[model samples]
Target: MPVLVKDYTWSETDTEVLITVPLKGVKPSKADIFSSEDYVKINYTPYLFEVFLYAPVVEEESSIRVGNGVVEMRLCKKEKVIWGQLESNIKMDKEEMRRKREDVVKAVQEKMEQEQMERATKKREAEKLAIKQQMQLEEEAHSKIEKEKQDERDKAMEELEEWKQHKQEETKTTSITNKPTIQPAQLKQQQNSKLSHNMWQDNKDIPDSQRPAPRSGGKITVNFTPRYFPTAARESTEKEEQEWLAKMAAARKIQAGTPSEINKNNPMLLKDKACGFFKAGDYEAAINAFSQAISLNPMLPVLYSNRAACYLKLNDNEKCIQDATRALELLYPVVPSNHIQRAKVFVRRGTAYANIGNHGLALQDYEAAEKLDPDNTQLQTDIVQIRNLISCDS
Candidate 1:
């Protein structure tokens, strides 16, 4: 649609021209004004106004103002002379107005094309950047995969070398074992003959006091004899067995009453003792104490968990998992089921699985623990590490 030109009035002085348009409620900033030395154009929404000046004006010295629902412009004249009229004498007929409108439309179209070109350039650059980032990420992933494969190859080579060395040692052992054996009596005879020969050769150097005395007739006598012993009487065996059986029975009676007497029906004391042993790095003793405590109170989940920790310290991964699982099972359907204690059990089980090289199961348990306690940074780190291990294994 063609814009409606708004009515405007203008007055001129010796050095300036003042133009005013009544807007009623519109702000002057809403108008777009294009000014030059000979022509001026004012455009607002649904309104376009233009005029040819009577003479050239200083375009840079023009000013616009808006107040009281009125928009005004002050155009400073280049020459200090009064203008006969606000506009030029040349009339703007229909053809000239159409030409001016077409010129304005062309200028606006050129500006819009320039802006669109700039936007297209920015978009292409952004896409290129995104593609570059994706390629970088892919390269990093490929490098990581290659590194893991190399590590596996190196590990395999090490294991193969170890096996080869072990086989070589076994071969040496077998060869040694296949050699002929000497009888003890022959070996003793050889040693005695060697000793006699050496003694005869060194007889002249021997001291008289250290040497064996010789008979005056130069005759030697030798004797070989076997030792004999008296057999034992059979009467003492029955009495010894009877005394041993009595002592064992008494020990069993004491053992049966010791736990009840020392613990006095309190399992916490046993738990404390187990913890003390654990703190002292005596895992075997700690495990025994924990087992005893668990036997005393089967429902104590902490006992099982503590025992699982001890098992882990001992490198018994299967027992660790079993005890951790038992602890979790005992803790269920209670207030502590989803508490930090239960989460710790899951972490313990996960650690055991990790130690046994079961990355998938370890990841699962770590994730479960993470859900129970999301703020645990260590658990999160463990989960990521296990995931990486699983991926590498695959």
Candidate 2:
């Protein structure tokens, strides 16, 4: 019997082998998967661009040859290009992507460091400035305190001289008008007053700039003189009274004093002078005047409160609080109806609290003030701003 032989060209599109049996020698009805006489070489489409074929098992030759069709391909293999130029372009693209990633990371790191350094520099500068400002304020306050002490001393000496001169004139007039007793104590007091007056005149000649500055280094020094306590009796004599009244009328022609129609010729004129000093930002002088006023009339809350305000401006928060507290203690229980007075102190305390960053305390004071004076637009605004700030911080 004879057998038929067929030849087939390898095709990339072929999937499986097609088998046929001959009707000739040793015909079997079944196909065998592994038999030397019953075998076929099958071709399959390559999965990717490259693959490796395994060598076929054979008995005759020492070395074997594998088929050329691809069986396996590397996972990294890409679509094959017509020319090598496309491969170079892909490699350049990969490098550029890597460079871009590195550049982005570097830029981010540099930006972060720059921001940190800038923040640190700002913090340092702010701290230094705060310290410098604090020191300057302290020096100013100290200077103001010292200057005020000197002014008080001079003013006292002036008052003593005036009293002595008045007393001496009285003694001389008495000696001429009636029998006089030259009391030794009176003589000594008179001599002392004259000496003090001369010393005061000398001190007055010293320019304020040449004089010692305030101990607290503040801009203003307060020197208060006690207004006449046992108010001096009016000098009698129709001629002299008319002359005095004429002089007072002339004085009123200039800038008039407040507390309207206050007697300009009264011995308490020093009180008004002190008020003027307070207005001039001379806390030392203001404080002195307030002290004298308080000494003469301890019932006045305005005097203490005014001094406290000056203390606050001088940055003497402790004294400010104390004086304000005293004013409130005196005024609150006695005059519960005084809203404006209490509001003023509350505003002062609130400012102190805000300056120290105690927003909670400041808020309390502001709220209290708002309750007392609902119509005060400025107070309403302050309360709103403070509440907003506290909310933000929290």
Point to the candidate with the largest lDDT: 1
Candidate 2 lDDT over 325-352, as tens digits, reads: 7777655432224578888888887876
Off by over 4 Å in 1: 1-260, 263-265, 334-338
Off by over 4 Å in 2: 1-271, 334-337
Shift of residue 152 alpha carbon in model 2, Å? 67
Tell me each candidate's RMSD, in Å, in order. Answer: 37.0, 38.8
Model 1 score (lDDT): 0.69
Which 10-residue window of candidate 1 scores lowest in summed lDDT?
Answer: 222-231
lDDT string, candidate 1, 1-394, tens digits: 5365557888888999999877645456455566666677766665777777779888678887766767788999999998888776554577776675566445544554455456656876998998798778777767776776677666655654565577567657777667556678656665554455353334464322222222123222332221112214553344544443454344333322254465433455556666656654457877987888766677667889999999987779999999999888766642322368888999999989988999888888889888888999988887888988998999
User: What local lDDT does model 1 show for residue 140?
Assistant: 75
In model 2, the worst 10-residue window by lDDT is 29-38
